[model samples]
Structure formats: C-alpha cells, structure tokens
Target: MFRAARPFIFRLDAERAHWLTVHALANAPWAAGWAADPVDDPVTLMGLRFRNRVGLAAGMDKDGIALEGWQRLGFGFAEIGTVTPRAQPGNPKPRIFRDVGSEAIINRLGFNNGGVDACVQRVARHRAKGMLVGINIGRNKDTSPEQAVDDYRYGFEAVYPVADYITINISSPNTPGLRDLQAEAALDGLLGALADTRARLADAKSVHRPVLLKIAPDLDDAGIRSAAAIALKHGIDGFIATNTTIARPPGLSAKVSGEAGGLSGPPLAEKARHVLRTLRAECGTSVPLIGVGGIDSPEAAKARIADGADLLQLYTGLVYHGPGLVSRLARAVSTS
Candidate 1:
C-alpha cells in the first residue's frame, strides 16, 4: 500500500507529505494495521523491556501525536520529539528537502515541536499499551548556550514521569550551536546537571528512568571518544549513534544534497556505522547503544547488530522502504 502511495506522496512537498501521513495515522491509528504485526523478540536493557529491536527514530514524530499509530505500525518502540521546554515555530519555510535519486533527505526543521508540556500531555494519554515509548528532549532555539542546561532540566522534569525513557538530543545540526554541547567541558556541565537532577527526581518520584544521549555522525575519532567518555562519566544510560550527517558523500548528485542541514538516508549509512562502532569500542559494552542512520533493509539492520548495537532505529529507511520495513528489521535482528 505504501509503495502504491509513494509516487503520489513523493509528488507533494516533502514536509507536507510528512504531515499528511502523520495526521492520517493520528486520526486513524488502525491504518497502521496494514503493515505486518510486530515480532515478539523481547529484550531487556536499561531496565526497560522492548518488544522488539526496531524503533522509530526521534525526528519522525516531532510531536507525540501518533504514539498509538506507531505502535500499531509494528514498531517495538517509538521516540518522539526533539521537543523543547517552550513551544517554538522552528526554522524558516522550505527547510525540508527530498532527493529521490539519492534516497536521502536534508532537513533544517530546527526541532519545531509543541513543547514538553504539550508532548507530555499527549504521551500521558497514550497509556503505552505494548510499545516502549521514549521522548527526545532539546532546548529551545532561542535559549542561549549558557542557559541550555536549565531548558533541558525543564524538559526532563516535564517528561520524566510519563516517558519510559528520555533522550537528550544535542546532535541536530539544524539547531544553532547545539552540537557544541558535545564538547568535553560543555557536556560535563550539561550531563552533570542532569545527573544531579535525575538523582533528585528519582528519589522524589520513586522510579528511575534511563537517559540516553544522541550524538551526530560528523564527530571525529577524538570527538567520539571524548563524548563517550563524558557520557560514561555522568552515568548516562545509553547512546544513540547517531543523529544525521552534514558531510555529503562522494556520489550524491541530487541537487538538494547541497542544502545546508543534516542529511539522513542511504548516504549516511557508512558514517553512522562508523560512529556506532567507535562508540562501542570506546564504551566497551558497558553502555547500551541504539543505532540509527541508513538502516533501510534487513542486511543493514543485521549489520548494526553485528557492529555492537544493542538495538536499531529507522527514519529515512521508512521513507524509502515503507512501513513494512519495521517488521522485516525486527525479525532480522531478533535472533542476531
């Protein structure tokens, strides 16, 4: 069904088509039943049980509007947002571009979420049924670098009770200076603040939740090790490697490839894989890792598992391979 609709959907503007799809699923979650049922290869990590290994990456559902829809679509887990403390309109128009020939997308959407309060409310209503749901949090674009930790703290507190896990998203290239948080000094401060906050919250709330860090694929060898070291130092729960890439690969000839933003899709597979491998080597299996990049096929998914990813996520893969890819990957990695 997705294959048949792909042509018509592709004809529309990339972002428009995205909303149409999101809203459709939002209104009629049963629509997800068209895809195969999710596999039952349970895994326990970070003290949370996941029905399967494949998850919907953060950017796909910026708002928590379609949690049930994603569950019905056969994802074992779904991550929503790069949500901010306060609502913001995000970057200018024409921020999302699609390159069909290259099977890639360049987006500078700048987090454009409905704030943590709104997202938390939506998440509270879902009741989670069978899917493990995570909320990805980020600071508002206008928040200065100095005050970033406060914004993240606000987000963490707002979403903590309702979220099964929380992802600290500092890797998006579209957000100005967001990546700087990955630096050793800045990261230590940010994660240290959150670690302290989490300790307090865990005591007050009577429950402990895992916090994962999402990093960009553009980081160099030294940078990757530094980020991993800091994450471990702060007792961070896990790592999602990675978000997206800014460097264009050799053969990407699509016109939009030149667009200034983070690129995701087939072209990103190698770079993302490298980061995942590097993180695993640095962290040495002590921390769990979630691999997200160009996993559009069963082979790519299996490769991620072989490379030490405890789980896998899909975004651009769904764009190119359709919803059924979720179940296929779950089955592929379930036994691997």
Candidate 2:
C-alpha cells in the first residue's frame, strides 16, 4: 500500500508528506492490522525487556502523536521527541528536503516541537497500553549552551515517570551550538549534572530509568573514544550512535546536497555503523547501543547487529520502504 502511495505522497513537501503519513496511521482503524505479528525476539537491556530489537527512531514520531500506532505497526519500541521544554515554531518553511536520487533527506527543522508538557500528557494517555517507549529530550533553540544542563534536567524530570528510557539528544546539527555539549569538558560537566539529577529523580520516584546519550556521526576516532569515556565515567546506561551527519556524501545532487542541516539515509549508514562499532569496542558488551542511520532492509538491519548494535532504529528507511520494513527487520533479527 505504501509503495503504491509513495508517488503521490512524495509529490507533497517532505515535511508535509511526513505529517500526512503520521496522521493517517494515527487515525486509521486498520493501522494495527497493517503490521505482521511481531517476531518474538526479546532482549533485556538497560534493565528493560524489549519485545524485539527493531524500533522506530526519534524523528519519525517527534510529538508522540502515534504512540499506540507505532506499537501496532510492529515496532518493538518507539522513541518520541527531541522536544523542548516550551513550544517553538522551529525553522522557516522548506526546512526538510528529500534527495530522491540518493535515498536520503536533509532536515534543518531545528527541533521544532510542541514542548515537553504536551508530549508528557500524550504519553500519559497512552503509556498504559504497555508499549516500550523512549523519550528523546533536547533544549530549546533560544536556550543558551552554557545553561543547557537545566533544560536536560527539566526534560528528565518531566518524562521520568512515563519513559522506558530517556535519551539526551546533544547531536542535532540544526541547533546552533548544540554540538558544543559533545566537547570533552562540556560533556563531562553536563553529564555529571544529569547523572546527579537522575539519581535524585530515581530516589524520589523509586524507579531508575535508563539514560542514553545520542551523539553525532561526524565525530573523529579520538572524539568517539573521548565521548565513550565520558559516557562510562558518568554511568550513562547506553549510547545511541549516532544522529545524522553534517557532511554530505560524494555524488549527491548539488540542488539538495548543499542544503543546510543533518543528512540521513543510505549515505549515513557507513559512518553510523563505524561509530557504533567503535562505541561497542570502547564500551564493550556492558553498555548497550541503539544504531540508526540508513537501515532500510533486512540485510542492513542484520549488519548493524553484527557491527555491535544491540538494537536498531529506522526513520528514512520507513519513508522509502513503508511500515513493512519494521516486521521484516524484526523477523530477520529473530531468525539470524
């Protein structure tokens, strides 16, 4: 059905097509039926039991608009947000561009979201249905980099009660000065404060939720090692390596290739896999890893696992291949 509809959907603006798909899934009575029975491959990581290893990545459902819908779509889990503390308009129009030839997307959407409070309410309404949901949190665009720790802490507190895991997103290229948090000194301080906050939250709530750091794919080898060291030192439960890349791959169309924002899709697979392998090597089996980038097929999904990703996520791949991709990858992982 998605393959048949893609031509028409792809005609619309990339962002518009995305929301249309989300709304359709959210509203469709038959949406759950669209997914095949999920492959039964359970794994315990970060103290949570995931029904399967294939998950829908953060950017696909930013506002938690389709929490139940994702589970029905056969995903083992779904991550929502990159949401800020307060609502913001994000970047101007045409922030999302599709590079059809490359099977990639360039998004400068700038963390546009309806704020943490709105998403919290949404999650509260649907969380009881028993979906394993991860909340990905970020600072507002206007929030200063120096004061970013406060935003992360606030996000952590707001979503702690409901989240299966919390992802601290400091890697998006669209937000100015956001990546600065990845620096050695900056990362240490920010994560230390967050760790302290997590301990307090856990104590008060009597529930210890896993915390994962999402890093950019643009990091060098030394940078990856340094980030892993910081994650270990701060007791981060896991790592999502990585976010989209700022560097455009060779042979991309100049028209969309030059557009400013993070590039995600097939072009990002190699770098993302490399980073995952490096993180796995550095952190060993103790620290879990969720790999996302250019995974669109069963083989790609299996390869990510081989490269040390304990779990996998998809966004652009879903756009190109449709919801069936989730079940296919889940089955592939299970049989492998």
Candidate 3:
C-alpha cells in the first residue's frame, strides 16, 4: 500500500506528509489494522520487557498522539518526544527535506512539540495498554544553557509516572547549543541533577523507571568516552547509540544536501554504527544500547545486533520502507 501511495505522498512537502501520516494513525481508527503483529522477540533490558526489538525512534512521533496506533502498527516500543517543558513552534518553515533517491532525510525541525505536560496527558490515556513507551525529554529552545537542568527536571518529573523509561535527548543538532550538554562537565551536572531527582521520585512513587541517554553521532572518540564514563558514574540505565548527523556525506541530492540540519538515513548508518560499537566497547555489556539511524532493512537490523545493540529503532527507514519494516526487523532480530 505504501509503494502505491509513495508517489503522491512524495509530492507533498516532507514534513507535511509526515504529519499527515501521524495524524492519520491518530484519527483513522482503521489504521490500527494496517500491520500484522511482529514476531515475538522479547528482549529484557533495563528491567523492561520489549515485545520485540524494533521500536519507533523518538523523532517520528514527538508528541506521541498515536500511542495505540504505534502498538497496533507492531512496534514493540515507541520512544516519543524530544519534548520540551514548554511548547515551542520550533525552527522556521522548510525544516524537513528528503532525498528520495538516497532514502535520506535532513531535518532542522528543532524540538517542535506540544510541551511535556500536554504530551503526558496524551500518553496517560494509553499508558495502561502495555506497549513499552519511552518519553524523550529535552530543554526548551528559550531556556538558557545554564538552566537546562531545570527544564529537563520538569520534563522528567512530569512524565516519570507514565514513561516505561525516559530518554534524555541532548543530541539533536537542530537545537542550538542542545548538543553542548554532552560536554563532560555539563553532562555530569545534568545527569547528577537528574540522578538525584530520580532517586527522590523512585522513593516517593515506589517505582523505578530506567533512564537512558541519547547521544549525537557527531561526537568524537574522546567525546563518546567521556559521555559514557559520566553516564556510568551516574548509573544511567542505557544509551541510544546516536541522533542525526550534521556532516553531509557524499552522494546526497545536491539540492538538499547542503541544507543546514541533521542528516539521517543510509548516510548515517556507518557513523551511527561506529558510535554504537564505541559505546558498546566503552560501556561493555553492562549498559544497554538502542541502535538507530539508517536502518532500512533486515540486514541493517541484524548488523546492529551484532554490533552489540540490545534493541533497534527506526525513523527515516519507515519514511521509505513503510510499516512492514517493523515486523521484518522484529523477526530478523528475534533469533539473534
């Protein structure tokens, strides 16, 4: 069905087409039946059971309006948001661009989300449905870097009760100075603050939810090591191998290749995989890792597992391959 609709969907603006698909899944009841159940490749990591290894990565459903739709579409888990404490319009128009031939997308969409509070309300409605959901939280654009921890803490406190796990997203290149939080001292401060907050919340709520860090692919070797070390020091639960890349690899459509933003898809596979391998090596088997970026096929999925990823995620791949990739990937990783 996606193959048939590709031409028309591609004709529309990339961001518009994306929201249309998200809205359709949210509003169209019949869209729930669009996929078959993914193979049962249960993964027990960070004390949570994932029905399968395949997850819808954070950027795809920032506000998570289609929780039921994601579950029905066969994603074992869906990481929603890069959500901010307060709602923001995000970057200006033409923020998302696609290179259909290369199956790549460059997005400078920023963290355009409907604030953590509203997102929590939407997620609360479907929190009991049993799908593992991770809410990815971020600091708002207007928030100064010095006070980033406060924004993250607010988002953390807001979604702590509902999120199966929480991902601290400081990797998106589109957000100005956002990735700067990955710096050793800044990361230490942020993680330290959140760690203390989590201890309090866990004791108060009497429930513990895993907290994962999502890092950018642009980090250098030294940077990756520092981030991993800090996270381990704070007892962070897991790591999402990479976010999008600012570096434009060769062969992308020249028209959009130079666009200022983060690039995802096949161009990102190598770098993302490298980061995954590095994290696996640095953190060893103790830290669970979620591999994403340019994973458009079963082979890529298998490769990620071999590279030491405990789970896998998809975003740009779905834009090109459609929902069927979920089940296919789940099956591929089930036995690995």
- Model 1 segments more than 4 A misplaced: none
Query: Native-vs-model 1 lDDT?
Result: 0.91
In the order shown, what is each candidate's alpha-carbon RMSD?
A: 1.0, 1.2, 1.0
Stretches of candidate 3 exceeding 4 Å from the true structure: none
Ranking by lDDT: 3, 1, 2
> How many clashes show up in model 1?
0
lDDT of 3 by residue, 46-103 (tens): 8899999999999899998988888888899999998999999999999999998899
Give the alpha carbon lDDT tens digit for every residue of 1-336 in model 1. Answer: 888989998999999988988998899999789786779888999998898999999988999898888998889899999899999999998998988888888999999988889999998888647668899999999999999999999999999999999999989999899999999999999999999999999999999999999999999999999988898888898899999899988767658878899999989999999999998888887689999998998899999999999999999989878899999999998864
User: Which digits, one per residue and each the tens of the lDDT, describe model 2 over residues 138-199?
Assistant: 99999988889999889989999988999999999999999999999999999999999989
TM-score of structure candidate 1: 0.98
- For all predicted structures, in order, the TM-scores are 0.98, 0.98, 0.98
